[model samples]
Target: MLSSSGRGPSLVRSAILLAIAALVATFFTAPAAQAADGQISGLAGKCVDVAGASNANGTPVQLYDCNGSGAQRWSNPGDGTLRALGKCLDVSGNSTADGALVHLWDCTGAANQRWLVSGANDIVNPQANKCLDVQNRSSANGARLQIWTCTGQSNQKWNAPASGGGGNPQPGGFVVSEAQFNQMFPGRNSFYSYSGLTAALSAYPAFANTGSDTVKRQEAAAFLANVSHETGGLVHVVEQNTANYPHYCDTSQSYGCPAGQAAYYGRGPIQLSWNFNYKAAGDALGINLLNNPWLVQNDAAVAWKTGLWYWNTQNGPGTMTPHNAMVNQAGFGQTIRSINGSLECDGRNPAQVQSRINNYQRFTQILGTTPGGNLYC
Candidate 1:
């Protein structure tokens, strides 16, 4: 090599070639995939918005209805920071609490600025083991942003725009974040032990991919609204009445109650009761629920699936599935009619239907969709 570093023509040429190779390597080995610029939807169907559309450091990050404005746009540059308005989402003074404010600061690659965008739709700050939450789960405009324990509330659900965000006008996939479910039913942990609820719903393509974006949200909201009423916000995994525990069994059925006469009591999200319902739900879910009614209470995915099955299928006392009732514009009333119309519809019990209607209305508002007319059966 003509004495390494001595200024020979061959040595100079080789050095230039090595430098070019290094440059080429650097060019080819680019950073990780860049997160697409879009809005991140959080509590109350609001987007993680930039206050006043300001790009300056220390700008407040709050929840606002997604309006496609540049202020609401965000990016994850594969560098552990969620960037918006060219600023990193930073935790104020690196605090970890139920209400530590989140704001924009210059990108510093700090641990407090890093986040783990989980499959459950939670923007978790691993440094604190907390989530990016809309303070107090408020749905109103100008709600403050904070870092709180990952409670799986709707306020902590950060749906990226590309995934059919929580409030964007564009069509998005149907997804129920654990956080949203937690917000709707704060008492779930006491009864439900199942995890991966979002993943469970994702397995059923029809659940999230149904109808347009509005319809999808309506469907999900309606389902959850009715379910909230059915299970008291999923606080009760099974019916509470001990007397009715044995009443669900129908001894006349061909298969009978394999899970015992008392085993077929109300269980799962929709309170799937009776021997026939257990058998049918079991057949649909590929599990022997007729012989194992306890599965619904013991398995979270099975429990939610049972509820969804009933929502998508059985009309109960109504004329169509609850899913069809919402998508076909039959209104929320039809869903009540489909579920328990015999008891609650046709002026039999206005209060019950009204309760369901109230839930639907409130849930729809939270989801940012209008609950259509005929809210009563």
Candidate 2:
């Protein structure tokens, strides 16, 4: 999965790459054949499409049997992002690694989202310093795209959209799309859903939907990155280590751990745990979570709302809410402090702190915002 991104390997690789002749023998499958406007015909003469023609962000940009549908109609807009159906063709996770998936996502001006037309129309992601490659050189329909070491092979060649002009700005209202959510947490439990998250947004209108457009996008990325780290990309629906489950109960609270000593174990995007946390969050959201902490695990809306509750209100170990930390330009580091500063910040746990930072940077790139400074707590 190593990339040719660095200067040394890139220079050498470039000098060695030779453009191979285009495919022939099968007229219908030859990408060299004339392509109609607004379509990027490639290997097998298949048009690059948003898988299932879905406008959902993070949809795969794949070589499918060309049918001239709207999914195949692309616009270069000259912005470096290849857009179709209102989303950019992006390298998954903003990844530069070889074999990294190329998918449709919110059009962020991030390095990985930009593409360059190389010799013979090879679309390249300068961030990865690799060519857009059809995985395995298969000419079959539904073949996916990837970033690979540029070999100048036909698989790396694309009848890409013309690079120039401006495409539509990302659709407003919500920064993170359902497909982008899936991309961020490909293995996330089904318990967390985009609809569930959006459903909970009205609960905290200013959390991600506030300020300037950049601020809005940045805040959304910051919140998701923090939660992604806390939940391991939403893969864990609840605390994994059962040994620590019972420790979340605090009998000292007046509520007395109504769901049981272990029922309050970590759950939801931010690992909302503890009897007190459940009780407080429930009261704030007007739901009875103390007796049914499991609702955070069983109901998607409840699960996401709990995470939003913490992000919008609870400061935990720090002085400000995670929401305030982001919108106030206090830097992503502050959110870390607010969430788990006692355990993970200020070199208390460098690796874990870094995991949160890495997610922040990657997600900000995906959301089309810069990760402002003071990333370390």
Candidate 3:
């Protein structure tokens, strides 16, 4: 058996091989599946607020053409619940009472709020044991939906429209609608507000660049798909001590303490921390690092620039193509390893350093490259 030190690299290699095999299998099967099953478009422009007063439950639910407003924005957690404006389509706090008011509330991870998207376009609240129903059976504009016992009614039916076009509604159910979905989470544009999925990719212009509309859309889709998984759907950040505090201050001088300076902790996209990183990022983005190390987390654009700088300059994407990483896995691994080591120059075992290898693996998977090979280190 390999020692623990040796095992880390070996296991990483194995993971890469497994990932490559999976990629090959997916490539062979995805096209056919895409053709046969049809595309799973977004639900942006087509999503409508159920008509009626936007208060709580018993509101008449009606479909209106989307206006790209927050009210029309919906979040499908893929856990069955569809959220709008930060509130969930809840079954009245999971009261389980029949004819319970379906009010929107903060997500509490309750069963009543837990939903399932059925094959028939029905948004089923299993805890309430009902389908989302339109109030008083009204089909007029400005109707809202209420939770009623599932009777398979037509009002409960929804149609998820295709992206950038008129979508045919599926028979017997509601579709989340693609146009409305994209509008709500409008690609890199959404990144401007938060450090989530849209923001992370947007932070890296080279990654987000699309030579043309077609290429842009494809690249955006792929980037979103992969980053969503890696970052846990933009809900999670890589920053350390995030759960406990809003910011972490560096107190140790051992890592790479400049002679008289204090504190050097990780922050922002991929948690770019330390005095050295701040300097490097500053150089890349033409910002003054020593003066504004906090900019990584304080400014979205700067955070993104820092991440791109790391990807391009420190991570070898600048000197080598992604394809080269595949061909020369050892060289790729070594470059990442070097970054990992150097990242600790300020302090050993920085949280970012601990997660570096995992992050790299995620990067390779997103790039659709094999993870294994030799170490250029």
Candidate 4:
């Protein structure tokens, strides 16, 4: 377990690798679903095609609807090779560069077509050491499919059937299809670290969904990262008090408040504070917030749930335009600014804020893109 403050560039890389390893282990721990019936849930409506058009080596393959045709009927072949329509799904010529095109070719026992199936949403190709990437790493539909280096991006994840199909059921019991799962959980790893962050999305219905919305996994992970960085991983604390409480502090009336009226604000996960937020969490969880504002820190699950409530309520990173914010750091520096400006009612040090901005910029650079823009706190 690495602390956020201690996570330098090298540590971040290690964390990413550790996350990948955890996902791989989880994938193997789950049993493979029966594909003998050819009844795949997610791929039923998607297209498939033969690689390379030649059914030979180095030919480009395309995706087309399944018509019981040999070209569309694929087999895992239990040898890391996908055999379908007498061809294999491959990375064109085994190239590992970014933006590499995927093609169909004859199966020669190469590693490109050999995939490790996790749930319905994630797949692993060992040869190129990457996952099948969705263009632009977006969650929108109709995005093109390609291969890219795996950095646990949401676009590369695919979900397979749970071993015994006994996990919690999503909104619908229908299991997410492999292709659809990949769309939701696209990347090399599927698990995210849960520590001090108030919003741990690991338990979100969106990430656990076995159907359509499961592709929002990356969004969930991003939310967790944003909140973790914002709140000092449960270290920083806030103060809580109700306006109606007897002897409450009011500058116009009294300078000294009653002992019971002033209480420590809830800490950790969602930073639960104010009567409104407590009430919201209470309503959502069917608890009485007025009686127990401390539930946030005392209950881990409740804390995380409150955090998700904020994330969902706010449009998240998508709320504002990237250009207006500059560098599009989203929840990172912007959140700190918000806290300091509104809550602290104190000016934040420009140097400290800029340092955080630099950290976020470096993070995005490692992932290979300039994130949209910064959310100016």
Candidate 5:
């Protein structure tokens, strides 16, 4: 076998696989899957556009009435990005703060250039955890676009390229770095990939980003701790209890389980079960999971998303969302009460509850933060 250094010419020839745009190879490790070009219409049927139809960098992106012009044309390259005029739609200054200006800039694969067009039609700068908005909600022509806190408001809604609207989203600004994640779950299953978790972070932008830095670290630790417990240190991909599989489908709902009785069994990091949960998570994330419940287990990003959906939205067997519990300083115990408290909270399952607490403590230590108060539910 030849040494790595001896294969230089062949490696050089292989690297010249294709001649794409100048920054295309630098931005993505591989070539883009597909580029769908179209008009990105926003409020009042106005198009998200480059002001003055200029291809120059730093042109302000704005909202203008649909005019079938190249200035209004955008491209979704199916790599969780939006571009126009050969430049990226960028958040100015690469700031993660809200109300940042959106403009055209050279595509350097920076976090500011990454965007996710959610299923609900919101164009989100995942790094900033904000939506592309018409400044001050104005619908008049030439209203400049900026990144604002997502409120699901009309000004934030958009009709982007169909191929780029759903499925994968750009992942950015995750509080837990890959190094920290690996330290926390050294034995984690390959399926629980770090990229998958970050990719899923776009599904709910405010998850670990809701509060101060300390709070952010705490929230990330709390979530991973719980996930570690759910999957046995992140080793198990699906619920090991095979007997529980067939019992997940409920026939009372208007739409019965189409994937068979056992299809919605406990899967993903949270071990999401029941047909209702699949439907709810799928609906919220803009992916059809009711009939294709297996996506949670099949796709790593989808699996992490199911866990995030439950963490950021659902109250489970307790009051208030887990995110609210942590952000509002309700303590870690409240999080336990919020997720699976019916069986584990109170005096019922102290050992299991303690196990979660133990994991939380370890993760907090790994993240260099305190575990905070409320150790027990």
Candidate 6:
């Protein structure tokens, strides 16, 4: 990744994006409950619904008029997460903050994704340590559902089917949804497609729901912070310095740049540049990026995957990959050292390193985590 004086804004925006995107839910095993069917009615007797009756991940779970529709039917499976339409009732982004939206998602065993019926009027989400709330206590139709401090208000009350609660709570693995992804980037939803990215993470057992909150947040924060500096919060799919584009091809290699000299320019979330990097990324991702470098800008998931591959593998200027720096308690500064330490670390370029640190600090806070010390290389 290359950074110039102009890269300052990239770090800032990347921090904002990471802070929000890291809110995606983390999964853990929970006890399962027997499935029971009924309507879960809340404020004004409105029914909890799978918006548009769509059984898709990140489908908005809202309060709608009760019309004896299938969308209103729910099952309280003992696994802690409420079930309807074969999907789990989830807290958007695993957010504990007041007013975080609720949605129906593929059930993951993560704590935030789990819900328990108190058998009273309250529907409790153990992960958030809050109660399901009707936005602003509005009793009107289409009021959005959110997580708020537990209150004994009628809006917080719920009526579900009676059950001693038997079906095993299937493990809800870590997977990013369209809704959660959008919340992470806020304004950059259209910048990259997330389906492939989400699927890739889900399919990778080693990287999916495999750590504690601190470890998870730190890893994600560290990775995105670096990439944000590289691509400017994914604002640019390719490098802006067009003059430097053609120079990325190293002719000395046994095999010359197959995509042509100018083709191997900086691109994607990590701004992958050089023919060697394109070839390596393409080989790992099972794509022909070396011969077709433009895929980085054309495919959002592919772009994200390439970035992740670098974070997880490359040692660069540091002794360990950025992923290891965070998970091993090596501190965020090490990650900076790993990415572009030669250019910015050891007081070489304090401005650039500080910019990356600023983003890292903000992201950790937004993730409800503390930024460990030694933030500067």
Top candidate, metric TM-score: 5
Name the best candidate (by lDDT). Answer: 5
For candidate 5, the per-residue lDDT at 23 reads: 13
Q: Which of the two, 5 or 6, has more lDDT?
A: 5
| RMSD (CA, angstroms), candidate 6 | 15.6
Q: Please, what are the lDDT tens digits per residue for candidate 1 over residues 139-231?
A: 888888997654445777666633222221212334445566566666665555436355455223344333456766777778888877777
What's every prediction's RMSD, in angstroms?
24.2, 19.9, 20.8, 16.7, 16.3, 15.6
* Order by lDDT, highest first: 5, 2, 6, 1, 4, 3
Worst lDDT 10-window in candidate 2:
1-10
Off by over 4 Å in 6: 2-184, 202-204
- Model 2 Cα shift for residue 34 (angstroms): 52
The estimated TM-scores of all candidates read 0.53, 0.54, 0.30, 0.34, 0.61, 0.54
Question: How many angstroms is residue 256 displaced in model 3 relative to the true structure, after the best TM-score fit?
Answer: 7.3
- Residue pairs clashing in model 1 are 152-178, 152-179, 153-179, 153-180, 154-179, 154-180, 164-172
Q: CA lDDT of 131 in candidate 5?
A: 73
lDDT scores for all predictions?
Answer: 0.64, 0.68, 0.39, 0.39, 0.71, 0.64
- Shift in Å, residue 102, candidate 5: 19
Error of 4 at 368 (Å): 7.2
Name the better of 5 and 6 by TM-score.
Answer: 5
Where is the poorest 10-residue window by lDDT in model 3? 18-27
lDDT of 2 at 82: 71
- Tens digit of per-residue lDDT, candidate 2, span 1-377: 00011110111010111111111110001123336777888787888888988989878888888888989988777555677888888888867666899888887777677765543455666444456889999888888889875545688777755434543222334778787778878888777888888877644434564445676678788888877886778788777777767777768877698778878777778677667777777776668899998898888878887777666655666666666677667788887876677666777888978998999888888877798887888
lDDT of 5 by residue, 1-377 (tens): 00111110111000101011011111111112222347887789788889998978889999887887888777777655677888889889876555789899988877678765554556766454467888989999888899865555688877776444433432336778899999998888999999999877756666775546777789999999888877889898876767767776768879989999988777888777777777877776668899998898899999988888777765655666677677777888877876667667778878988999999999899888898898788
Point out the higher-scoring one by TM-score: 3 or 4: 4
Clash pairs detected, candidate 5: none
Ranking by TM-score: 5, 2, 6, 1, 4, 3
